[model samples]
Target: MIYNFEDLKEIVKSKVSIKRFNHIMAVVDMSIKLAKIYNADIEKCKIAALLHDICKEMNKEEMKKICKNNFSEDLTDEDLENDEILHPFVGAYWVEKNLKIEDIEILNAIKNHTLGNKNMTLVEKIVYIADAVEITRNYPGVEEIRNLVFKDLNEGILFEAGKKEKYLESIGKKSHKNSYAMQKSIREEIKKKN
Candidate 1:
């Protein structure tokens, strides 16, 4: 209800494609609902969801170039290699630097949404997984995951993340699609279950 649509428009103009802005807005609305359900920080979730795909439309080549040129050495090799997934990190950087936003929590939510790190904050996990399972999204097995989110978010996030990790790995057995953070998060998630 309190979304800054004009700010969103300005932000989208620079970082996201026109088509993606609507998707991001949809995620924003869904995330707000999730925040209410999960007791997460609503403002953080909204900002994170709105800006999640800010760099989604960047051509893979351009994405790679931006990441290569600007990212700190802190990024893992897997992050460097996966341009498709690296867009979130790039979007966070641009948002921080250009938009002058200093909220690390919001930035971290956007930064790690793709390959979730271990011990993510509530807002972080909610935004990360919610973007994947928003009401409007339709992919194979998505409905089950959506139901899982309402029942148990941690289980849902881990389940989907694990599934995605496996799919990415199956894409290349030797050079698996799993990132160190993703693997770490799954183990952390299992530990929580135990």
Candidate 2:
């Protein structure tokens, strides 16, 4: 895909609120740094990170309608069934349809950045962690996860996933099945390593 950073940034800035736009920029910076350490494609990382939340402000009904075709199969039943939480899929689909990205890995990273899947690729994992620990984000234990990012990508991913779980419970929201499965898989991997 031909990804022009300026064009992508303009499109994103035009669509999202200032706070979200800043978050997107932070994720882009973090993604690029993590991509270098993790040996991911930097250009793809840039595009995916910038566009990850492009549809965050979009209405759920519109997302659901477009997702009928663009996001039907890849997302979990939890995602497909719940209109409220389908931003990741909607973002991925909208970018592909509008930008002609033509890179499934980039699209996949955007799709899974919110609550990652067990089968996530390196690019996906980088984007997910970057989104969680981006400099703009202020949360408990975020510093530890930020430090762990380049030092240990797997542990960083697990840490962020666990933090996300706690945040969900505190807010009285249920995590997607992918979040649980991803956390379980990461825990097992960390255990095996230890």
Please give the RMSD to the true structure for each candidate, in Å: 3.2, 2.5
Measured against the true structure, the TM-scores of the candidates, in listed sequence, are 0.82, 0.87
Model 2: per-residue Cα lDDT over 1-194, one tens digit each: 57789988999999999999999999999999999998998988888999999999998778877777765665655566675468888888888888888798998899888878887778888888899889988878999999987799998888777777888899997777778877887788779889
lDDT by residue (1-194, candidate 1, tens digit) is 34575787676866666667767887888789889999988988988888888887777777777777876454556567777667887888877887677788888898878767667888888888888887778888898888888888887887787677677678873322334565576677779879
Q: Backbone clashes in each candidate structure, one number apiece?
A: 0, 0
lDDT of 2 at 122: 82
For model 1, the stretches where C-alpha displacement exceeds 4 angstroms are 1-5, 13-15, 59-62, 69-81, 173-183, 186-194
